[model samples]
Target chain A: MKKDLNITPLNTLSLVDKVEMRITQYIKDNNLSVGDTIPKELQFAEALGVSRTVIREALSRLRTIGIIDSKKHKGMVLSHPDFIQNFEKVIDTNLLEDETLKDIFELRLILEMGMVDVLFARKTKEDLKELEEIVDRMETNNSESTIFKLENEVAFHGKLYEMSGNKTLQRFQNLLLPVFQYVHEHKLPDAEPYKYSKKFTTHRELLNYLKEDDIKAFKKGLSNHLEPHLDRILEKSKS
Target chain B: MKKDLNITPLNTLSLVDKVEMRITQYIKDNNLSVGDTIPKELQFAEALGVSRTVIREALSRLRTIGIIDSKKHKGMVLSHPDFIQNFEKVIDTNLLEDETLKDIFELRLILEMGMVDVLFARKTKEDLKELEEIVDRMETNNSESTIFKLENEVAFHGKLYEMSGNKTLQRFQNLLLPVFQYVHEHKLPDAEPYKYSKKFTTHRELLNYLKEDDIKAFKKGLSNHLEPHLDRILEKSKS
Candidate 1:
């Protein structure tokens, strides 16, 4: 075939990206599901009119994202992309700008607050018991400190996400944890002192609302629980 | 140096994953920001006690995530990771399960509902003008359809995200779009018809709420707008 010198490669996407898109389109067009086998490199290269090297690069990108797994004998199989794998790859806290970190903290609040309906709709006795244990552990801490360790906070909230029975939402909560931890450890600029007033509801109060299936009260309690952190985010943004 | 028989690899993470993590740690430890040059492959391999090939593999993974860029004469440079690059690599609709798709649709609702406060807080006159144009277009569509086309729907909601002035949240909304499209096109297993009654508020009404800066009313309007889609997800879950 004669080279077409006049034709410019108008594609702004790199060859690897283009190939990746095509592979995804291929999977969709073929109605391929998880565990389904994908074509070999040579076959893909020939089918897509690209070189084997391009195919290999695209497949490597796919494999990195967990979209296609390579087994001992199987060439390549479609797989459910692990949310953590992709999320963790981009979540180097030090690399993220301060504003981005704050945005993530805000996102955490949004997700937790928006989860009220699902949490109430799906809470079970077992879920409630686990949450109660976490709250009780906080209450009985020998240190006599009302402040929660990061793990304690994560356990209580993580339990709530699990009870929501939405794996996708749970994954989002897990992904946001690192940012939350960063913010919690290093308070935002101009962060105000947390008010330890009698009116503030603890996890126990929130749990009571969940137990009673009072979503309205649960939302109010949850908001009260998250108020200190939310205030920091709002204050930081204002300044 | 002689190899010792008693020595075992203590790290459970794959060599590539470990190297990737170490490289990220290196960037953080050195306080490297976007456009900052990182050490060469040979330097990293020596520092991390790994082969150049392994370092290269790890760097490749980082580059795919946009955490690092390999520029001519610049070696590896730290860069901001593009959310879409990593997100697009995994968002194969065919590979996603039906329940996962529904979960994503639900996530869209959560994000939109959560956006109300921000939208009202940050919305500007220019934003209102643009939104009014979109709503006007929707009203004047030749089909005389109160129902929004997918593009129109995206424009209205996308504009709201933009007006919220949170780039991270906007990116998230953009990333969830494919799954939203999938759900909209394929409607859930037990999807119901949208009740387009005279009482149902349109985008125009939502705009009026925004113009009046009535977040409470806007939330109610937004909820009503998303009601049918939310109903489908809730209905599908019941089955």
Candidate 2:
């Protein structure tokens, strides 16, 4: 065998990045929990063998993300990270690329399709009734409008996510649903008319499949329901 | 309708929060993008009728999130906010509750199961061969091991996600996969010896499903493959 010379690439992480990893490590190593106090900056710097300035920058980033609670006597304390709030805070839609937005929008479609089992397992009679009502409104309000009534579209899909009963999935669904709306309003405009324009599945059809508990048919119908989006995104990418 | 009283909740957003929203809105309304300079602090203050201090705090928050490139000429310019970097930076594992962790862990399951179509559609022959090699390693590395070879488990699942060809989903998969590992190592231990011990679908079986191009079977198999994680999470929640 030839000599094994698998040289790795040089470390690309900045000092702050490495220091931040070390500090998060210290917390995990000590099994720290929310409201727990971490060591002062000097102690952390000394422990991690980094400069005080680097530790300070790392700590500051943590505080900015609401990871550190400075309000506890204005000292360093671990706190519950409000991710939903933090995600909302940092999300500047204009700064994101169209590809990033479409990827996120596609994530919603994937999640919706992935969640049919959860939906069927956990749905209640009232859930079905509400879904039907939303679809009824979608049909009533300008059914000839080529696409959809925005509010009803959200309600129909949001209701399905709610029925999934996975709190994590719901949180992600809430965060990502707006990306879909944004894509529909902005990037997906002026598309060639829907490819499956003849046989596109509506919200009501999806609800009926759910009501029958026919998961396979429901899944196929969802793929159809969301086909227009995929078609538009694919066409745009090809162009 | 006796005395229509459909009042909404009071506004809970603080001045800084409102100003941040306004600035983001201004960016969208003006179609400002990367490298574009935002209005100076005083200009924003005058336009929004907010104090310079409020504008300062809002801008500071934006800087912390990397939304505003403060270093470009030492003034504010729109920047591509690096979400993955920011997410990794802010994540403090010790502070997250088991419930939150489980929620995120469940997200991986949903995403993977949802991505069967992508994997099937996009997986190349080389992708399959590499997957087989990884599974072979797992097989050789003490196949009797009840849980998994941690590195191999990550490799197998990560490969599947890579095959999906969704950049957003892959980023999310990368971020959330570690959470899965964390849960597996931390919270999900001491699990009652695995519920599907008798009939669990291993990664090998999932590959076979893909090889046969049976999408529905592969989807069902992925659910079974991930069921152990869910079983444990549900069991803990119930108890």
Candidate 3:
């Protein structure tokens, strides 16, 4: 109770707003199971002494993020999985601008660099097998065109991210996919794809290291994979 | 047009919904000056053959991020000096969860680490003076409570971020403030404050290095400042 003295109270909410926060907090506090119906909107709103419209807007935003689902007859239910699904739409609709793209691109690299330990710690044989197949496809593709290699490149490393078992990190990587594609498509030709290819061979080496669970080598491999991407962007900036 | 064909489109916006894209393109194409008003909403919407509502929605999203500002009488103008303000609200709302917080925290470190290069590139006597004052205060108030010290810690680093003179990076550092606060608030008790004080001394050393524009030492100092924070987080995780 004494500690509570140091904590400021949250801002006051309207009666309708109170009902909304109550429900959202209820879900979080109770760890509400997905697909379970929340209280009936009318019943819930009335119980909180708020109008239905106020409850509707809050629920609408939650539903917009896939945190809940609503049906005319069935009412509101919690169904939110990953919050990134909501963030993805916000970014995709041109809300995210050029600078945000660049910042996010840097964000992706930082995540990748930090992910090495996690990737090696949790990597599975099945994960390595998938990565090998992706690398094989990358080598066989003759065209210098980035478009062809970009998706495979994302997949190979994406699997590595999944190996981290950090769902949020994996989803964050995928969320930055558009920016990555934009960066790849507009990339300068000075950094040879040949150079990038050799670097990606490190991913295979990384897989080997992961099999042994070598944290040092795995970090080095992940860092090396990101180096060219960072270098290419920086180099493009100068040119 | 042929170049456009070479690039695969990654979005699903209808032409009407693509008004934001068109607006951005128009700004880049014409090299429109900042603070320039956009074409009349109705005219632009009609030319693009989209309803005013669609155009308005696109513009509103841009406005929310400080990319553009609208006046009831003056119409919409390109006014954004930075894009981070929008993200601040989202960050404050606790939209980013645990792992996203870690990713963001790493991002702050990357910026702090990368900043040595930029700092020397753009250092000034005034910046050095201000940073020293912050460090001096940290030393003078060795008995400062954790809450007060933590608040000053961000302020000091945030000042460093501002000194880098990169608007994009500064905004990001600010946007990540909530995540940084979250990490710092929950860390181990006894050793952290001491190690954190070492970071302040490193910050002073970084300023000395910056005064000489010695990037190598500045980089070393930057890394030193960040090491304790990272280690503190890492150590807490192990326990």
Candidate 4:
């Protein structure tokens, strides 16, 4: 076995962390916009009393999160970090504990239910058509192969998230999709049996509710559609 | 004005990005858990056919997100990224566009509504007692100073999020708290007048609903509490 390296107790703050905090404060203090150029690395090093290497390391961290971008012509520009991209990197299903995964599962349900008002207000005719087509494809697949691909489920929900007209919320839903799918596929301990009965409302029914602009009916239909997973979580918790 | 540096068109993938992806994949493939020691930097450089500097840069990025922690004796250990900490770094209220901030405002509302089920299910007697005290504090402050500190409002809501028994959800609420506070303090464009009248359900009323395990009443009370902000958003969207 490899021996442990001689470790020192961690300081409450590391030099790199302090440098990162200083850089963030600089951006905020300057009120930098997406395309605004940040000061050069050497300037930051001098101002922060850190070495050029420390500044470079801090910049690399910022770039990793999409908060700052370095171009050949532009040294560093403030940019909106891709929250979804950063989240996707770390959301490996295998890496998460089961409780965390289940929490994500519940979060997805909450998001789907919570976005109904936006969906009713913001959905366009084209969005409806796209959703209808996805539901149609699901129906065809259900009848032909008697199997529904996970992508089909994701596509339908993804379309709804897009129609909600909240990009941040939509991105968050997309970020959680993988964990949602992982739970669905694995049927982890405490997962109830999938409800295959035809009595529950289908995607088409939910679409009809959406098309009618019936928020109540749509919420009802959605709750019915999501009941199996919700029931699984509820049942598991009770047991 | 700073002279533009000689810029090159960004490739779809940067070497650093590739290395980052490879490192993430390595962690997954190795099934590394929190506190598991990562392979040495030189070992990664040799395996990935990159220089040690590239490996160090990539590792720095991971450290920024809390995905890897390095200690003198421990070398590097895999760790769960603290989503809230990273988010706080980039969530500068002044830096965000007004639209994005508004979107966050709506997201907070959604989260609040969605958490009701979990709150009802998981809230303990002690949780109720704590919530009562917060509401009591607010009432006392309102009676004495005729003003509700924003901290009181946040404390009441924060307690509800905690009672939901979802750590991920609670952290998200905490992460978004700053943006929420920003909107509250600034009275952003389209914000409706804050209701000063005693006509609506008070926090104590909401607490009563929670005590009785009345989900419907709780939701109604919460909706009434949030109506001013919700009305503002809805009205703004119409125009």
Candidate 5:
């Protein structure tokens, strides 16, 4: 096991982590505005009291995360923040076991349920029209089989995500596609009643809520719409 | 913008991803059990039609993820199946942005809400005792300050995470702390209902529900507990 002792600063980290933390500290300490250009490599290393090799390793990670854009001739420029950078690493390390998967599963459910209020509040006419088209396409397909339902399923949920108008939530919903697939494939249950009947009812209600700007009723309807899925999910957890 | 056309695979990746995939595939293909020693790097690369560099990169990533263990002389031995291996590169890269943060926020909310059932279902006598102790300690403080409340707040919610019996969720809850701190610092409203009461009735109710094993009541109570924060979150989103 890797000991957690506080060793001397010289060779403390695995060279990579040491370098990475220095850059992180730089960003944090300098309060460098997003998109700011990072200091020159040799300068940064000198400032941090580390080697160029360490700085380079740290910068490589930052570049990977889109935090700093690196070019051949030019130095690093600050870019947008990226959260999936760490998530991807965690996943790549194959470290998230059954326990983590369950955590992710719960996360998906929470986001799905919480989105209703936002969806109704922010959805647009164009979004509603799109939903109608997706629902129409969905209605034309046979419902008994899941394979045929894949596209429509994504369409409906994707529309819901879009309606929520939270781009972050949308990306998260997309990222969870892998875990979602795993759960869906391994432990799928029958479509709850609301999934068929109330799906349209809730959609119409939600769209109307959006048009009318009924925040109170919208929240209620959102909760009601998600009630069935909550039950189904809880039941699955038990079994 | 990083045009997809501008993207090129890293030098180390060609051999790495394929080697990793092939190794996993070989294990499955050959029905190799855990503790199975993978073929020597060169031989394995030859069999999989790849270079040793690629195999090594793959092995390196896998090793990092804890899927396979490799020592100086022990060679590489298959470890447990880990799904999180997919996320290492993601984490290493700096791609999460505002949209992704929002997604993570919503995701955290979803996970928090979904955890209610898990909390109640899996609560033990000891768990309840520990929660009671934390709340009891929280009751001693009269401060409404976020920093002051943080200690107790984390304890109470951390207990909930533990009850969910999901380590990933627990670690994730910890991982997202900085983001949560950012939100609390920037967005949360400081309002009334704090001068007289400790304003943690919901936690008491949650404890009651956990003790009684009332899943419905527990969820309701938890939602009520979260409602204030959720309202503030929504309001913050607007502003």
Candidate 6:
């Protein structure tokens, strides 16, 4: 069944874990793709010099993660991994470490800033209209306040993410939604000078930058919008 | 034993699935945080009117994903969720859909673009020196070529991600390395005009932009550097 790689299991990882890794490596090394038939468990066991039970356990882990499935007659087959799909369950807020939550929050901001060009290239009349309408709705409610409501902010920015047409980014945005909300919930006080600098970019202001098709201004606008959080993240790093 | 939430099991989802959702809901409603003690299985079973077997299965799923753990006499306690840690195993390219892979590649570029300010803020003498050395190493080998070697590219970009000082971004760059490698290996014939306007930004050119600390030009440089892949992602979306 096998005559190549040595199967001396290491002490650091469980045998099952070691087998799972080896199997993935085998698939990659062999250039197998989705729908490719995986060899039988017995073959794997014999090749790796491990028991069939260990092979089964490793296969079970892969199966649980949507990497492989048992075919009706063809035995196990590789399947497409829905890695982003797991974000729903993986993003349990109560369990994330503070630094991880902070890191994710930074990631969300980076994504927002990073997508500026994509949004410009892909924005439709309808897309801009939707974003403008969301901003308009927010402007109506704000008699004098600078910040928009969370729902309105979500609507405007969600539309922008939708405009980028990246499904992964859309789902990733959903995943980071909690981290941003969590940070806002436990928000640190903004630096007085930063706030007094009067550089806050409002919803409509950002929309105008988008409507004008200005990548630099839009990026700058987005940064200004996220300045408080950005400053907080940078401040924590320095300390 | 009685509970507020209605627990009639749904036809669509398994009983275990339903129980998992309800347990998470209970945790949120009760303001639970990390290390909080989880209620006993019997108590949950009685409260939700589900069998202890169903509760156990649901808890096992939670345990595997590391949302909760059993502590001495303290029973099950909440744990920090490591959503980012799973990216390594979850990012198996052998099983990812092409579209998903493309979207992820797009995300990596976006993260690179998005982390500009953070990179600028965090870049140190050591970081810049390392990046410069990588460029120098690449330049010496390039007798005459527009593109740098793949290893050199990885070193340069990996260093940039590190400069952002984002733990999550660093791991994410690792997750995306295969996607980029795969795309380059199976690269599409790039458009004709794109090959010529003379806009391909080289790695050292990007490093020089960074050294200058011109955020605007650096973003433009980064965008030029990624224009090919970005164009490909957008072109596919249109069709």
Backbone clashes, candidate 4? 5
Writing each residue's lDDT as its tens digit, candidate 3 over A82-106 gives: 4354355444443345655665665
- DockQ of each candidate's interface versus the true one? 0.44, 0.50, 0.09, 0.42, 0.27, 0.54
Could you say which candidate leads in lDDT?
6
Which of candidates 1 and 4 is the stronger one according to DockQ? 1
**Residue B151 of model 2, lDDT score:** 77
How would you order the candidates by lDDT, starting with the best?
6, 4, 1, 2, 5, 3
Arrange candidates, best DockQ first: 6, 2, 1, 4, 5, 3
True contacts kept of 1: 0.47
User: Candidate 6 — which pairs collide?
Assistant: A95-B80, A95-B81
Clashing pairs in 3: none
Per-residue lDDT over B1-239 for candidate 6, one digit per residue giving the tens place of the 0 to 100 score = 45566685467476877898899888888988888998999999999999998898787667656688778889999997667655667676456777777778788888998899999989988888899999999988877454557678788889999999998889888878987778655644455584658857898888888888887788888888888777777776777
Q: Please, what are the lDDT tens digits per residue for candidate 1 over residues B122-187?
A: 788999999999998887783855345667878998999899778888888888887888787886
Better of 3 and 5 by lDDT: 5
TM-score against native, each model: 0.82, 0.82, 0.56, 0.85, 0.68, 0.84
Q: Which candidate leads the pack in DockQ?
A: 6
Q: Which stretches of candidate 2 lie over 4 Å from their true place?
A: A1-22, A39-58, A72-74, A142-148, A185-198, A232-239, B1-19, B41-57, B72-74, B143-148, B185-198, B234-239
lDDT of 2 by residue, B1-239 (tens): 63486663447567887898898888888988888888899999999998998898788668768788765465788887765656664554656667777778777777887777556767788888888999899889966565568778889989998887788789878888777878878877555764456787888999898778888788888888776676676666557
Candidate 1 docks with a DockQ of 0.44
Every candidate's chain B TM-score: 0.81, 0.82, 0.67, 0.83, 0.73, 0.85
Estimate, for each residue in A85-128, the C-alpha lDDT of model 5 and write its tens digit. 43544443333455456567666766675555556556678887
Model 5 error, position A71 (Å): 4.0
- Model 3 misses residue B32 by how many Å? 18
* Deviation from native of the Cα of residue A8 in model 3, angstroms: 25
Model 5 alpha-carbon miss at residue B169, Å: 2.0
